[model samples]
Target: MSTVLEILHIARFGLAGVFLLGGGFFVLAGAIGVLRLPDFYTRLHAAGVTDTMGSTLILLGLMLIAGFTLLSVKLALVGLFLFLTSPTATHAVANAAHKAKLKPLLGTYRQTRKGDNEGGSQ
Candidate 1:
């Protein structure tokens, strides 16, 4: 292949790698959020938003690698399906929780660093 074509190919793969890494990061962050968050609602919010975004980015990376092929078309369809369904599912769950009288924690949450505490400096 020509130098320009080779460069283009390298650029495509590089971009795909970036997208895949970004998707992985978002998914990892979402997992951490779910584990660390204080309440069901907050955890749900983290999971819902990041799950959709993360999957979309990952699928996009896969599509880029697949190029103009049947596999890419299928991936696009799957992405569309998830993009539509995930938010709907999240909303449904939230609504059910609300109907069941599950309330989110309200008010302020304060966390002090190691050196700072009730003693005021150390």
Candidate 2:
């Protein structure tokens, strides 16, 4: 009985650690996307999607660690709130930007070398 309970404890912690690590990865990737993406809409999408997912994973980890407690309940509620709000906020901002005439970059761009136009007439 003792060994079984001990294993359960270790498993819970291991699962929590995995959730936390995954959350951290998503958050980091979101930050990178916000920095590296070309346009406002794309950046907003990256931030919005990752924010909800990352926060949910982190809160789930916290809930796992909290285990059948009020803290876990609170974390769940917070997660729900963020899950509902983040995308709504993102959409609202995107809509506003669109209404204000913010345009996204479209089409392909290729940089040609100065001497690379050999196929055409000089």
Candidate 3:
């Protein structure tokens, strides 16, 4: 019985480690996406998907490792807060970008001619 309990504990620890690593990778991917994406909307998608999920997963894993203590409860609460706010925040940002008339990157290759005076008076 004691051996079984120990094995279970070790397994939980391993699982938590895996979650942490995975979450970290997701965060890194989000950062890369923000850097590499062509436009604001796509970057918002990357950040919203990756940041929220990574934060939630990491918090959940930490809670499991914490084993029902106050810290675990706090971590769970933090995760809940993040789950609630991340998408809302992302949407707000995207909406603001849209309202500000930021253009999405499309496959249009219209090159400005010399003296075209784009974004200026004719």
Candidate 4:
């Protein structure tokens, strides 16, 4: 019985480690996407996706490590909130950008300078 409990503990720790690593990778990808994507919309998408997923994974790992405490429940709630909000926020931003006439990067507009928010032409 003790051995079984030990194995379960080890399995939980290993799973948590994997979740953390995956979350870290998502964060790194988001950073790279911000640096490399052609335009604002794409970059926002990358950020939104990464933020939601990375936070969810991280919170899940933390919850696992936290066991059945109040802190664990709080972390789970936070994760749920993050999952709900990130994409909605992203979409709102994208819609605003569209209404504001921000143009996508294609062909001639391949690369715009950072901090340029002219919103293309009317």
What does candidate 1 score on TM?
Answer: 0.86
Identify the runs in model 4 with alpha carbons over 4 angstroms from their true place: 107-122
Error of 2 at 30 (Å): 0.5
**lDDT per residue as tens, model 2, 1-122:** 99999999999999999999999889988989999876676789789647677898888898999999899888888888888888888889889888877766554313222333432222
Task: Please list the residue runs of candidate 3 whose C-alpha ends up more than 4 Å from where it truly belongs after superposition.
Answer: 108-122
Evaluate model 4: give its lDDT. 0.80
TM-score of each: 0.86, 0.85, 0.84, 0.84
- Candidate 2 Cα deviation (angstroms), residue 72: 0.6
From the highest TM-score down, the ranking of the candidates is 1, 2, 4, 3
- TM-score for predicted model 3 compared with the true structure: 0.84
| Stretches of model 2 off by over 4 angstroms after superposition | 109-122
Task: Point out where model 1 deviates above 4 Å.
Answer: 110-122
lDDT of each: 0.82, 0.80, 0.76, 0.80
Error of 4 at 60 (Å): 0.9
Writing each residue's lDDT as its tens digit, candidate 1 over 78-102 gives: 9988888889889999898887777
Give the CA lDDT, 0 to 100, for residue 7 in model 4.
Answer: 99
Which lDDT value does model 2 have at 99?
80
In terms of lDDT, the poorest run of 10 residues in model 2 is: 113-122
Clashing pairs in 1: none
Model 3: ten consecutive residues of lowest lDDT: 113-122
Which candidate should be chosen as best, given lDDT against the real structure?
A: 1
